[model samples]
Target: MMDHTDQTTVLTHAGVMAMLAAAIAEAEATGQPQCIVIVDGSGELLGEVRMTGAKYLSRKSARSKARTAASIGAPTTAIPDAVRAPIGAATGGEMTALPGGLPIKVGGVLLRGIGVGSGSGDQDVAVGLAALRAIRAATEF
Candidate 1:
């Protein structure tokens, strides 16, 4: 049986804005234009930003990446190929198997996801991780 009334931690609008700022800062520091997307635990879009000069296609890719991470409750890179292939197919490519999407968790509970695009995988992952670190620092006492 599932408890529909169970309390869950969710990303606040301010928190999502903070994440976007952090990610943009990181991308700027690296001289890489990026598109960043934030999504709730249920895969709903919370916030998004497309940096100046970022690829137009990145907007959609970033959203899919965020949705993938939130839907699976894990970093996109950590999804095993065995599962990734099927989910990617099932979702008609709505899910991405890329390295730049990260699940945001607090106290072992998934809260949201952050995804970065319009850069190399490493660059995207770096920006996403920096945003996660910023969120944790802001929220922790």
Candidate 2:
């Protein structure tokens, strides 16, 4: 159902970096300082940035955002925590049911990742989406 080349295209550090930068810029423009995180397919940090005035707890929230996206391989907001119960229980609390995290995908395969926080959940998700959109617009992979 999936191909190895597709997987490779989606997980590159460059791709992840681009997405994170775009997300951070978008968040900064909103006047609500935020923290942005990018992780690899395995949930390892690829990139991270915190904007001015971002709250202290935003760092942890950003991590949770990335974890949620990486675990589910989708936008974190797309799958709320209520729907993550069974999966979270099985994963031993690794999965999250929150906003501001997103998985980078290419050709339907997950590559790098995204996470945003320090503002409202909706703002966080919005910033993450802006990053994804930039990625999608920049290149096919």
Candidate 3:
């Protein structure tokens, strides 16, 4: 029998929406059209939004970035190109080495990942980080 003793914490739908709102607000503040994606720990998409005037390709890129971060349990930017290139190829380009992807965690337990695209890497990262901060501010975990 498999032991099921370990407990896992996941983000609620409300939490995901809160993050999205914050990300969108950040993008608006900077006058940046952006695409944002949120994924659960299993790399399943939880929520997504593409702001007005965002590039068409940004939707897919944001999803890929979120999935990559969730799969690796780290920020996508932290993955070296040496490691990311092959993985990107192996995954049929479902992964991205973008800097806007961040893993969402609480007390060492990963909850999800948030990714932003259609802006400069720095701007995307700022939006993603803002989302994480919003979640932290709204919830205890």
| Span of 10 residues, lowest total lDDT, candidate 2 | 3-12
Give candidate 3 misplaced runs (Cα > 4 Å). Answer: 1-3, 137-141
| Candidate 2 lDDT tens digits, 33-117 | 8888888778888778888799977877787778778777777667754667776677675666667787777776666667888
- The RMSD (Cα, Å) of candidate 3 is 2.5
- Taken over the whole model, the C-alpha lDDT of each candidate is 0.85, 0.75, 0.87
Poorest stretch of ten by lDDT in candidate 3: 132-141
Best-to-worst ranking by lDDT: 3, 1, 2
**Candidate 1 least-lDDT 10 residues:** 132-141
Residue 141 displacement (Å), model 1: 17
How many backbone overlaps does candidate 3 show?
Answer: 0
Question: What value of lDDT does candidate 2 attain over all alpha carbons?
Answer: 0.75
* Candidate 3, 78-134: lDDT as tens digits: 888688789888888788898898888877877788889999999999999989889
Model 1 lDDT per residue over 115-140, tens place: 89999999999999888977775332
Candidate of highest lDDT = 3
Off by over 4 Å in 1: 1-5, 137-141
Q: Rank the candidates by TM-score, best first.
A: 3, 1, 2
C-alpha TM-score for every candidate: 0.88, 0.77, 0.91
